[model samples]
Target: MTILDLPAAEAIRFAVPASRWDDAYAAGMSEAELLLYRSNLLGSDLTVTNFGGGNTSAKIMETDPLTGEAVPVLWVKGSGGDIGSMKLDGFATLYQDKLLGLEGHYAGDQDDDKMVGFLPHCTFNLNGRAASIDTPLHSLLPHRHIDHVHPDAIIALAASSNGEAVTREIWGDEIGWLPWKRPGFTLGIMIRDFARANPQAKGAMLAGHGIICWADTAKDCYEQTVRLISQAAEYLNTRLAGQPAFGGAAISPLTGRAAIASSLMPRLRGLMPNADNASRRKVGHFADDAETLEFVCSHDFSRLAALGTSCPDHFLRTKIAPLVLDPARLDDDTYLAQSLEDYRALYAAYYQRCKRANSPAMRDANPVVVLVPGVGRFTFAGDKATARIAGEFYLNAINVMRGAEAIGDYVALDEQEAFDIEYWLLEEAKLQRMPAPRPMVGRIALVTGGAGGIGAATAARMLREGACVMLADRDAAAVEEVRAGFARQFGKDVVRAVACDVTDEAQVSEAFAACSREFGGLDMLVANAGIASSAPIEQTTLELWNRNYDVLAQGYFLTAKHAWPLLKAMKEQGGTSVVFIGSKNAVAAAAGASAYASAKAAANHLARCLALEGAPEGIRVNVVNPDAVIRGSRIWDGDWRRERAASNGIDPGEELEAHYRNRSLLKRDVLPEDIAEAAYWLASDASAKSTGNMINVDAGNVQAFTR
Candidate 1:
């Protein structure tokens, strides 16, 4: 027995409330309330509809309160509204007759854009929301309630090469099949006409698009949707039931997964940004979910993934075929570099080939999905959320194609049809609403000592400026705590924490590697991990000296050593940056602090050397020297508070803060933010030409200023 052998009642989780059915309109509720309740219920099952993919609607008549005349309204899901979370506002109430009347004046050749322009005039106080493109299609249909969904199972048949034949075989005259059409005014009219021609049909599969089901009530339409989807699933299961699960020789791990991921991430990320400029940046997010890996490891992954999307709307979301990576070439940076370049070139060519005179100017021709043979999939976008969302859609597309391949041939619309949706005015409108890109919009950064006050604050600042951050610290629990807080502010995936002691070579390596694997690259390295120790030359012990130098000086060396390869690769595209957090003690020695001051002095010198070496490769290295910052500082927490107060001959709390605040030329606390701001300049293109320099952020530390 296979998935199809399951009992009908057990297959799908039909979540429509029983109370909703009992409270039906004529039975006791208004059409709007029933439709809304039903829409919410339908959206609750993601198997039927994924986020922002489908719509639900109903035709209702409500009496005009003032005129005492019945008004017909088509309550359809609006643009940018997820059916799963649909509310009354999510549905745009449009005058049904007004929408249907557009076709009389709208030329048969008019695309979705021209028809969409007329929607605002027809909407009935839609609260500033425009109806979805599917709104006109729903209103044109004679059914009282309609549901248009992208069901993986149904599309397996609908998006197949033999879709029309399969539809006729399964549903007979019960449903009509309309081959792919550019959806908008033209497609809507075509669907309505097909329904009229096949008056006995219950619903229709809009080939290479999705399925539409209709009935007099929302419940009937929903139930028909479930029943039709189930039939398709069962049909597909039977064809695929006897096939053995995919198996092949295990893929050899490329070098160390850590090191390869560490190096590969930056190389790929470096290429994502425009090579001609420092600012045209985009980020990559790596995901190796079970499904993604399973499919990519299968025998047919190359062919199936290279094929276009199973539906038309997916063109707008995933672009054309994903940029494919040869599994055997995963370890080669040179090979990966050329492949990504080819990927971009192909996309630009595809756009040029299909673009119309009126089409919007092409955005960057970057692949939304990058398939890495046995390694799995990496999704790219300007931000983490978009990448993850596109990943979900790509995963689903893979599954749908798998089913279609088993049943027949997995087929999508032609290039022109895909271009139609990809450049559709309605779809472009959504991308246009995105906020202006920030300086580090597509960059990724790694911050060490992130559990500490300055380190955590720097990470927060980087996240605000639009860089995905990896927070590495020796304190596992503290780093996790800081990570959770950053997650609340930035998205959960936007910030991650790794328990890595920078002083330990192995831990430092693993931590940086994880950053690459998770974020797909690294652009900025903020080496701020350090500890201070105070002792006279006579009292300084071997143990104390080693600990201070190991953390303060050796740690910076280790991080730079492990990070240089990635940064060098990044230089092939735009500029990359590195900053080592130094201390005022490095330049102005304090009594009984030979070990602390000397180590920081060495670290600062290392930054200067790195700047000299990395300059040819477009990597900038700098130092941010900060003086005493006591209040709310983890470095000054616990026993350090007593030590600091004793050294200053003052009380531990207010007095300690006042001592540092008064020491500054600005007569204010030399804050971690002040230092972070200095680092930000070095990280951004704003300091593109400034490298090998010490940026003093000590408020008024005249002693540490260049002399």
Candidate 2:
């Protein structure tokens, strides 16, 4: 493990000026405001440290000394709020005394009755969802200021089996270590009891979780967290000195750092396209640091490469990691597709293990970082603060993990344990508080035959609209590769790729089920997967007819049947829509395409029937028929096109041109983006009142037939 060592002088100080402390205190600090402040601190610190997975809190007091009245309000970080931009009201507030009472009821013996009554007064912001289950722990602590951080140094030691023993050796009596427990009232009780028993202890470590420290001042809490963890990190680094040699695929000596940095300028500019040149210049300056360069170069050949996340909470802003470059892999599209599949599998495995260990599942498993062989790291966040923080923390954690591996054995928290923390009750509660009805925020959606031109385009469109989309196809890997490209271009939450043959009911059903399990629920269905085989009536075969109907007709029926109830529920709650990717072939009587035309016509009728049946339940169903979308698609390639052209006794290029420029009123080829846009419109609120409608997206090709 490469260990990042922090200077000793910076590790032991924990004092903030009284004036600064007073300013924070006087900031009309409501429970919400306090929560946001603590969140920002944790987020900032985590970005600086590596993979800092932890929480923070503040105690707000409502007291009337003369009237002999006092009320303690606990404002704690909600599960999903990124610390860097955590706003007021982002923190969930609960009555202090109510939470403290839960400390008396241990996790093993606590019943639902006891749990419900334990904190009746505890309510999160109506929009924020549930409070962190750690509310109880924060309430029970004596200090008004509290901070919990997962310092890379401490994690380096704590993730191992001998973490407790190592912690004891490093801090001795000054620190305490608590065995990992499911975080909530149970963990709170354990910490409260430990605090009471060890009054002189400065901080406590939750093995496999993180570290916690409290003080009368925010600076004290912050400094203590940084210093203590920094000390442990330095110690580990010293122990590992001169061990594992860092030689791998050596970076070329001729590749100047400046040139590498300059090469990345365009990408960075693209990453922050909205920002002006000056702002981009500032961002570039930050990205060009030596530490950033070293960290980027470190992953050239390491087996377990650090993609660049400091902690899980970073997902709210920076996402998981930077885009990694591998010199051996050059085709960006191909690389993106393959890498996405690898990422999804890893996430699925992680989620399964976590579930087995009795932990709740996370929403999506998209990789935050992309590994590009030679190119430097490309950090992504929703905003600048998150990106900067994530960048800093990624550098530090990479160094520390590398150093630690060099010393003794380095172990990470088990997948299940990590899952438990990731989906802890506190986190779940926080999710519940969002005021906006993102009812389907973590739901799954499946688009069949999604690797085909229109299908692929629709899948990408749905994903960008915030659906955890699964693109199912017979060519599973290829489809997933396309889905992955979309995920990379957008964000991980937008898409997922799964392999399946839509013509096979078993495969289609299985794909839908997998997507549901991965994302928690099934919300929207896009039965856009279909096949087209054109032939003269005399030449059409039973096999071709069966294959076409199986996908274009039976496939849609099966998908709707399985997904109806979920869609009904979503619609009842408002904001749910389904779109069928139909084809202009259904309406136009094209020669030598009897099988293809019949299948699409049947699908169109099925969609209309579905719309009628689903509308009563509030589920809107619509269809879009598009023609001539040949760019970036296999439909225009190989023997399939050759056969079509030969039937017309025309050159392939000219045949395609006639189909596009001559047949359509627009005198232009229809693009996938055009079809995608229609799909989006049908799925959004803009079409809320327009159910049972068929949108034609053919660029004038249909006009000739209609006329």
Candidate closest to the true structure, highest TM-score:
1
Report every candidate's CA lDDT.
Answer: 0.77, 0.59
lDDT of 1 by residue, 87-137 (tens): 787788878888878876776664457778788888775457777777777
Candidate 1 residue 566 C-alpha distance from true site, Å:
1.5
* Local accuracy of candidate 2 as per-residue lDDT tens digits, 1-707: 23233222111111211112345453776554545654565565542233334667777775534355767767676645555666665566676766766645645624422453455456522333356545666777787877776656666565555667778888997889998665556666678789889998887887655677787755566657666866776676566454332332234222543344333332332222222111111122224344334434442335445433323433333333344455454335355446655665676676665574445455545443443333444444332234455555555445444444544444444444455556655455555654542322333467776787777777767665445577778786788788778868866555667787666677766676555433323446777776667688888899988888887888888888766754653432353577888888888777888888889989888888988898787788898888866775566666557666776677887566676666677787788788888987887666779888888888766442542
Residue-level lDDT for 652 in candidate 1: 87
Off by over 4 Å in 2: 1-54, 64-68, 82-88, 103-120, 123-130, 160-166, 217-219, 233-301, 306-326, 332-366, 376-400, 419-707
